[model samples]
Target: MLRYSNRSIFGIMEGATVFYTVESNNVTNLHQFNQELRNLFDRLRIRAASDGSSRKFAAGNSTGPYPATIYALMQCTPDLSKQDCDDCLVRVLGDIPITCYGKEGGSVVAPSCFLRYGISLFFEPTDDTLQSMGPPPQAVLPPESNGANATIINEKKRNASRIATIMVVAIISFLILIIYICIYLRVMRKPIGNSETTDVSSADSLQFDLGTIRVATNNFSDANKLGQGGFGAVYKGRLYNGQDVAVKRLSKNSEQGNTEFKNEVLLVAKLQHRNLVRLLGFCLEGSERILIYEFLPNKSLDYFIFDPTKRAQLDWARRYKIIVGIARGLLYLHQDSQLCIIHRDLKPSNVLLDAELNPKISDFGMASLFVLDQSQGNTRRIVGTYGYMAPEYASHGKFSVKTDVFSFGVLVLEIVSGQKNGRFQIGENTGHLLSYAWENWRKRTSSNIIDPIFKGGSTTEMLRCIHIGLLCVQENIADRPTMASAVLMLNTDSLTLPFPTRPGFFMNKFSESYKESSEFIQASANEASVTDPYPR
Candidate 1:
């Protein structure tokens, strides 16, 4: 049987659909069968609806003489609230009399809950269930003529056998655990590259021969070139195994030296997350330093957000997803990863998108590794793009996770407004993107900062993102939210955000200086940074 109700689950407003089935045969003893099934259902329901429990599934059998046993299972969708799960199961259970009462076997399936029962076992017993059953009833040996003495001797023998078996298993388990720990330590401590030199010969497994890369890129032909950055040019290449890869061939005279190149290879290879780009391998032959990465078909965020025609393709949903993705990626870098990394040069161009438009943070050349306990660092040379740079870092060379947070804020604003950070112009009014967003936000006209293309998008979500962006770009370093807090704000709608302070570098005071500085950096060979001027 099938039924539909005007009740919703999992955010779909269409309602819930339920399907049920029952065996043709009926139990001989309806009272006993009903009692057993009821007990089983109660047990399974409690298991699936228990508070603070991660498990949403339960299965077991009830003993009965009428049909020997009744195996049953209950399951609820993981996202459903405990109360919702109980209510759904209760409604489904109420349908038993009408659909499958006294039947030998039956099943009810719904979007949020499932119920199944049979005369025979239909599912594997889980470990918990097995443990609940305890060890199988010990084999009862027939009493010998010696009676009590034989019984005592047999019990002692069984005890000794059990103890010996347990000891053997314990020893084997300990040895296995030790072996695993040793293997883990060896892999964790494996040398990434030569500490004395930039050569990565120590990481033989991740080394790619120059000949292979040359063949893949067709001897560095211009046709395969993807784009040029501060470090070098990237090329689209096909390996011998039919896998497409992005090959980054470093420029010999580029600002990124052997140290930065080695750093990129080491950091990227060890780091792995869905939001971060995967580094496949690298080639270190002669003066050529090439790094291979998984090719992302959609290219970088800048390719779409900055282009008028392409920006149309990114609706509010995709834009919000990209913003959230970048936040999670930053959170992973700053906290979740083994090394607390600060990607000093985070910008739209460094945020690559895969075929599905999922954001993946890339380019670790300017990233810094920080100890878990370390909160900040200083450098004499201030690197990274101008508009995205935090006020403290740009002026005082003080950087921390907040530096990346500042850049993320700018990127979020850009995504929401579909405008670049350096110069934001709307009609006669013109200023930095941060200034524009803050001005409108302060005036309760935050909708003005949203892209006009998003005609019917969620205004509230866009405004919230803009608010988060402002919070990130606060002039005071301490005022900026950490990536973790930013991520929480983006995900949780109930979170009440604190009032934002003035953003760093607000207004056009530094507009001329920023432009001049950007131009100078672009012109000067030694001062040049990877801006990724062209779309990938």
Candidate 2:
């Protein structure tokens, strides 16, 4: 049996719920047990809040009496900040006097942290501990009945071993021959001049006839239109096999040539990750350049996150999940995938949500491919939404992985604040979101930038996200964390984050710069395309 208690203490944690339970059995030496428990709690608190540690969990034991040992464990969710975890444990430690005094075992549970202690061992031993215990003894077999029998057995074993070796060698040789033949055939079939031609030919199996797509999308009717972007319109289609797909029909006036479009389709089709939208097939017939993707039922993230009424549906937990998912997707594109890719345009509108609201990054029309070792690239024609592009990329035509990092930072701020980036207005103060966030962060009033709807949310987690966003949008390219580092930061609470510098294009400088560039381009080549007026 357990003695349970629930308390709502405003002083300890405002509007936070605390639950605790204690074993009914009383301890014989209450004083000794209490001292041991207190020591364990202190140690766990320190370990959980240690700098640069990814784990927020710790377990240990303390000797209590002649035969009694106190096994204690404490943990805070990976999302909580180090200071927040320490404070939470301190609060719970204070409650032991009221909840678990004189008890042999007890547990304290809170929203973001929990602790438990018992007289007996409750967790499995670590691998090192098991190794320290030594290996189990092996059973000894009885001596052989006779020397003659032993000799016969040895002879038979030798023959069996010889036969097994011969069979293994034969199998390996056959496999090698088959592999060599396959490689030779592949080399012979590969085209010599253009490797991209090979990529297109290999993707021929994924090509769909125009008639099939036309039938699936009901001849591109208005009712089947899902959304429209600079590239073209997206239509919901149902194939004859009862499979649903999202069809993207590229505009005839697209500047990308037929070969470049096909190459992009092939590259995108090869990318596979849970956080990335799957490319099913493509159609390149005559003037039509179409790509088909797995249809998502819940639509894009912008549908919910930007709508005031639907924004509430995404609480702090959901929003944090989306942010982490997007970071992971970017990490995969940048480092994990076989081909290094930079998502030139990453925004809420380009991120689709599945039935469970999990994020799947979509839209690769503006994506740039990089060699495995290459870190940066230069492009003359700039393409992406305003307020999301890094200052260097927008003004100087220099693009890199950090360019996407800046856009991701803008997206993170938008998700947390539930407001767009450009032209962000707070009461009478009208300015860019980056400048406003930087100002609030410098003044230690970061909470002012958070959405008011998150009244009961975990303030520490939200503030940490804002801090990470600032880190990503820093003006110095070297200061911006890579997507991998950003993901680690999102999941690790105890890590000591570096101080963020001033964000690029602060005070709405990007708008003016982009406008000037657009005007210049219009008068000269008329090639630049600014998809969205403001960040999505």
Candidate 3:
């Protein structure tokens, strides 16, 4: 553990400000490249402030068989002690990118630590450095045994046992010290408050610093804003490595349970599928709770499917692919994933598309988990888009895998019709998409609800999807096909579909009087996001 005393020199250097940064541009050996840098850094860390006089520190990985050699040096003012010098260098190393990221040669000279590196040896050998550095291996030595090389001395066999003992003891001591240091750092940097983010540090390797995220997101400016969601807004970002990412920043005063939302998000992160959006990592600093995801260039499904000009881009092939892709994603969540997850909010806006137009299910803020044997659960709060909620769920606060299946059904209809279910235009009557679909199905004019522009595709396949969609939205829970069955039906052309009864949201306008306030939205016949007034 590092304990900087009050009397400790928290001082900076006034001289020796110049440092020669060295690295090789032609080095193609990745293993050797990284090893050289690490070896040099490790050596520097060991010698940092260790020589009593904090004036000079030097290290290099020039002895390895690899032709590419990496050299480095860090030094502070001679007045500072070893600890102060070490702390200063440590702080510099913390910001590796600012000092040296991809450059082959660079120098970072700060008041605390002066760092320098280059491809060539820039510093001459000094008597103190040569004496302090360890002894060089003998010219004659046996070939490596299990990656270990031994030098040939007059009493090689005699000193072998002693050397082995020394190595073992050093390794053990180093490991113990590392463990102690890790525990101390974890305790020091641990999140404050009741700690909904206690387990967050377990994935610290993937965690991005708050400062780094802010820089990548351009301080969450309006230009970088993707859009607002139930809890907050999503922003597009590009990391220092040129990797694109999506940042979801939750509203500070959001009414949703911060701890519960994070727990579910962490659970969903373990889920891996081509159709499901990848959760990169999260940040919890002060009042900020942000979830990072792999950036999707094409944005959400609603972005394309809901727009007049963009809707035309979704050819029949793409639309069908989206439908099947979403089905497979749900199948993985409900059955294939490590845990059974019910996506409480599976609307078009939450389904993101990669560059290839492939669908990936995103936004699990409303998702709930269940065990393999646990099929159904209830909640006092009904949270999900209105048009997609299953009858048994919105009214009674009960939900299951079938609830998601009901939602998937609505998504299919929306994709096929290019219209939202909540407020589909129907000759100025302002009817629900599900009701218009059912009326068309009953009147033997199923094609009426389909997007007219999406013609020349397989007529039979299109009708079959509508049939499956209707089956999914059936008022009876038992009547709705499971995701497994729905996928099978979508992939199989010969599968017969039973007649679909009235979908849950059909003629649901009268139920608005029973609406409860929601964190996402309020209720109205003209529009609805998380409103389901059913109270049967």
TM-score of each: 0.59, 0.60, 0.62
Query: Can you tell me which runs of candidate 3 are displaced by over 4 Å?
Result: 1-201, 254-262, 366-373, 426-430, 508-536
RMSD of each: 19.4, 23.9, 14.8
Q: In candidate 2, what are the lDDT values of residues 375-407, reduced to their tens digit?
A: 677777777776778889888988878888999
Residue pairs clashing in model 3 are 20-117, 21-117, 21-118, 22-117, 22-118, 23-118
Steric overlap count per candidate: 0, 0, 6
Q: Rank the candidates by TM-score, best first.
A: 3, 2, 1
User: Which of the predicted structures, 2 or 3, would earn the higher TM-score when compared with the native?
Assistant: 3
The lDDT per prediction is: 0.74, 0.74, 0.68
For residues 1-536, write the lDDT of model 3, one tens digit per residue: 11133565445433322222335453456446545665676577667577754444555434566565666666555556676676666655544433355555666554455666666765543433444344644465446642344434334654654664466346434544654576688788866774223364455434456766786799999999988755678899876545788998877874546565565556657779999999887776778878889999998899988898999999889999999999999998777875567777888988999999999988664334343345578777677766677888878989878899999998898998888876557454445677778878888988877787866656777888899999999888898888999999999878777778888756543345222212122232221122111101
